[model samples]
Target: MLSLLGLLCLLHGIWAAPGDLHSLCYDFTVIFKPVIQQWSCEVQGKVDEKSFLYYNCDIKEVKPSGLLGKEIQRTNTWEEQNEMLMDVIDVFKQQLPEVEPKNYTIRGPLTLQGRMSCQCEANGLSNGSWRFSFNGQIFLLFDSKKRKWTVVHSGARLMEKTWVNDRDVTEFFRKISVGDCRRWLENFLVHWDKMLETTGPPTVVPNAFHAKATTIGPRLWTLLVILTISVLLGT
Candidate 1:
């Protein structure tokens, strides 16, 4: 019974899709201080029922600067992403203090005009470049290497460039960018190129398993015991 309980606990924990948000629509409200402006960003995949593979990024209240109409820049180090996002937020708080919270919807990448650019390069080799635009409901992404426009929400390709979509693009993009459009664009291309070529979609082969086992073993045993005790007591 104890073993069964432990197994059940492990199963439950693992069944929650143990990663970030992928293939899901993400919406969040951010408070711009002082007068309190509520800015919301909604990122969803495709509008037309027929083509569900694409994505759109829309910001309400403000036109959003970094995402569109900025020169493309790349982060020198991966660790700097968080700092960059904080800077963007700080800028927003400083610039826009008191705008009423209103639902301003911008669709697709046609009417909206701006250039949010980022280049991913490593070892002095340029991997690719990315630009994002919004057309009321859809967020359009421009890929320099592919030299095409794609819906940012689509997953078949790593940002629509390669056949690798391991990480939750939306979640990762949000975390890395922190509502700053440029960093989001920059970080996506950076990680896509850095990981896709080297790591190649996380593996379970012994080497990978061994590394995870070392980190996860202690936690698993503790969880097993806790589950067993909790279940036996019917608590």
Candidate 2:
């Protein structure tokens, strides 16, 4: 379960983004409990808050979506992105046992979800973060710039300590967040720019306009909202 402090922090983090920033994020979920069936993993990639690709571990394939997906597939980084996601699956499998809650008496279904994001501001500044949640409760956060982990829940303290002590794991997280993710974001931005140019600028409505916009909400916001509701429902 997420601590009160952790919930507040999560809410604050999601709403603190700048107006002119662009972000690329990868969200992955791993199922761990209800042990009668095979465990599964699913990954989704979003650019500028829209999903462009999906990877299912069972199928071991990357599936692209829409015109943006078609454009991304033509890039050199497409293969690299596939390989990186596969690596993420392997890392999650290896670390799941270590991060599992040891003292929780209630047992049913359990899940581990990770979201890694790279954000670029209009002025060319870039940064990234990695967040992990267990059973829909945010438990850990990694700041790429600081190369440090913050444990959001008390149950996750040991997991944080263990990961911090592992030099290889620490470096792997740092490299992926600050290096690979940022590079991939930059590459995707080039394609996104072209797509925007071809489509023209988005139509804007004045504040006085009462008509509802058709714009889709961000994937991160939807996920976080669902998680928050689940927490409130005590499910």
Candidate 3:
């Protein structure tokens, strides 16, 4: 089984950048079992390598994490940003089942991980991308410039086809990644320096796992089995 800690390590490796590159990234993980009717989700936001905000599905609220988060909450656009994130969660919840593999029987829960990032270089260049993973293995990537979906794992081919053909869904992803994400990053950058001055060194905890090894929920064990089936069947 791929532990939550391992999954976070994978994400950090993908988002790691040079000193001059700044990024605003959101990491979302959702786990659910239709059988038991139990589900949970977590959304985390980071600027560069520092985590600033977190949302818990259990509470349906966004909470500021540190000094940077407090400052961000004070901004006039914070409310709007919060609402946008909530909407994103709602969309994901609605869409995930639409792409689920047909005639595939799973013994346990399902895990879906999604990441959206907007990157800015010191030279005024900017770009954005979205990635989705089923059970910890990345299966889909979005190219903002080309407006296309790249399927990494064949199991996700259906997902890519469905999303690419749905103009509304594709445009929604584009607008958030290319437009709103960039604007939010720029706004956050305005307060970046001052906030850093008052805070400690940047600590990147993509999700709740920060230690070498930690206990995770039972549902996480389903990841490896599902991943294996996904790879073999190309669902």
**Alpha-carbon lDDT, every model:** 0.31, 0.72, 0.71
- Candidate 1 residue 178 Cα shift, in angstroms, is 18
List the candidate 3 regions with Cα displacement exceeding 4 Å: 1-19, 200-235
Q: Compared with the true structure, what per-residue lDDT tens digits does model 1 show for residues 77-140?
A: 3235334433334432332222221233322111222222332222212223333432323334
All candidates: TM-score: 0.22, 0.75, 0.74
Winner by lDDT: 2
Q: How many residue pairs clash in each candidate?
A: 14, 0, 0
- Sort every candidate by lDDT, greatest first: 2, 3, 1
Using lDDT as the yardstick, the better of models 2 and 3 is: 2
Higher-lDDT candidate of 1 and 3:
3
